[model samples]
Target: MNLIHRAGWRRGILALAVASLLTLAAIEVLSDEPEIALLIGEPYKAMRQRSTASIDPAIPGHSWFNAPKSDARLRFADPQFGFVTPLARFFTVGFSRDQRIDGVRMSPQIEPLLLDDTLKVVLDLQEQWRNAGWVPIRAEEFPSFADTPQWRDRLREVKNVEKAYWRAGDKYQLMLVVSRFRDNKRPTEERYLITLGIHRSRGVQ
Candidate 1:
């Protein structure tokens, strides 16, 4: 072959090699296991930073709801809170992907975590809030939530529900709800849903 033809052949080989490398990288990113996946990039950085973006409400004692250092991918602020509803902005974690949580929208892509791992998250949240002087309210205390079938079912699932509130003088009270559920489909493909929300206190106005 002439020099020009030889050069063209070399260029084609180089392009083909680059394409193969890119394809392999994409596969590694998509097929990463859960424990390693969450620790890979920005989400891991946020977790290490112990970001409280979603939990830090405008109310007092927000510092109490921070996620545990061992956990990652904990999101508190629902992306569509004030735009869609007047209710206080919500919080949730453990979903494989983020979802619009205006108290109505639910996430289908739940993350599968073991029961023990799920409880660790809930206890972490409850401990911090309790230390900050937030009082745990009984179900009967909030007739509206206690009476709702949806809330009742959610509470019954795994029986891991925590409801508490903290007051900021007389201005307003921040109500907190946290729950975790396992989506039992396949043993190897287990998933769990850890949800949390902050709303205006049930009765105090």
Candidate 2:
């Protein structure tokens, strides 16, 4: 009887240990944050579903919209988390001909009213990206503002424009454009327009 009781107790403890491990595994899976790199090649429907479900409605200004001029693209703006850059205003995903995600772009808006705070956030994000293995791309790899029509049009009125580019291996690229302009209405006052975009490397697609 003693031998049988000891064997039963050992089995019970083993079962409890297994159960505990399973529980911990489940918690880890549930707590895992969504990653953009993982979503890059997924189908549009699956990406939308996963992204929508992950959004926290409690986050102020969080919203979704169909990206203008493209039915295949979906945009999530001001999400609670899971963005490479903090305080991002928009996370736009573009689909390829086969309906799989081909590209993702995220940008944080620089609030005119809160310029000081927003600039600090932008600097912090840049540091985080660099620490996470992103390196500046060569100047020759990007187009000159004078040669790019779109950029010329965008910065026509700006006093000066500064551009920076970064790459993460050959998988992704990041662009930062900062334009300083005099407020048209208040010519004495100056303002800044900052745009940041991250794109999947064309070779990877």
Candidate 3:
């Protein structure tokens, strides 16, 4: 084809792409929703804040009955069991990929982690366990993970490394990824709960 034709075609294609993006943006804006996903991970390693998410007027909630927004900004204490990062940003949106936060856009392409929620937390824990320098011990019952204690403690890096939650039918189950502590194994994944639903499930022991 001639240069003129090719240039025209390129311009048209670019225009179409821009138009598509604008349309998507318009749609997203029109929707009266949070329009984001949240990320959640295992118990954050160090920081601890006792919080209960309840219907807050500060956030956009119901007027008469006070309905809570379907979404909210997500944050996490560092996974008590050290994962590569501490927070999950699937249901929430944090800073970056390493720090346990992405964005929950409408697309499945997944530009980053979503708001801090259940899925994000679980994924972060799985990653931390994967790289804790243990020989893989395959198991069938757990179905999602296995435990193998075959790493050297020369550097003393792992401080009570523990497994994360894989969703069971009605409840959550925790595992032990690594448990070599500095002083004592004080971190029990049992202490963590869904960052979003902590108030609702006030029984996280």
Candidate 4:
């Protein structure tokens, strides 16, 4: 995906309002990819969340409500199997179509490693997600490693958003990361994305 960045200035408390408008304007004329929000009109239950009858060491194969986690913070059983601790947390809030929130509060108690030193702030207050401990890793560890099998089996698929755009203005930027995580497609997506964003992107720092 080709990311676009725009610069802006704020006026006052109404700065948010101004920036939001400018962001919309930038997006309107920025690129030529007809706006297509990821297909997330409906949510499917991950197989794992479907049956909690037993402490299924085998990570769920279904969706959440179907096999709910005792701790909402625990995004996956073997985080390596999916987005690690904090990353899992950040990606889970809107994972379900039902609990989608436009904004999320960053966890003051965030993992230092997960924090993108370059991008610095992973997801800003209005960025839609916050790292709650879930981290990202290669998908091979999970059974779905072969193909990222299903959304429930792939960590990347879980993090993908339906509609995301960044409005760069100040210390805190407004951005959205849309699209469902690749279901077990590329096992090394995190490594690839990290390499791309950090090594390829210039202003990340």
Query: What is the clash count for each candidate, in the order shown?
Result: 3, 0, 41, 35
**Global lDDT for candidate 1?**
0.40
lDDT of 1 by residue, 58-139 (tens): 2232212222223223333222211111111222322222311112122212354554554455556555544544555443
Report the lDDT tens digits of candidate 3 across residue range 121-197: 54455565455422222243223332223322311243334332232222222332322322223343222222222
Question: Which candidate number has the best lDDT?
Answer: 2
**Candidate 4: which stretches are off by over 4 Å?**
1-39, 46-86, 95-205
lDDT of 4 by residue, 1-205 (tens): 2233223332343688888899998866533221111112222223224322222222234223221232222222222221211222122222233422212222222222221321232233222222322222222332111122353233244453322222222212222222232325554443112110100112221
Q: Which of the predicted structures, 1 or 2, would earn the higher lDDT when compared with the native?
A: 2
What are the runs in model 3 whose C-alpha is more than 4 Å off? 1-16, 19-32, 35-54, 57-139, 145-205
Whole-model lDDT values for every prediction: 0.40, 0.51, 0.32, 0.27
* lDDT tens digits by residue: candidate 2, 29-82: 644534332245555566545542343222223223233221121232212212
lDDT of 1 at 56: 21
- Cα RMSD of predicted structure 4: 19.5
Indicate whether candidate 2 or candidate 3 has the larger TM-score: 2
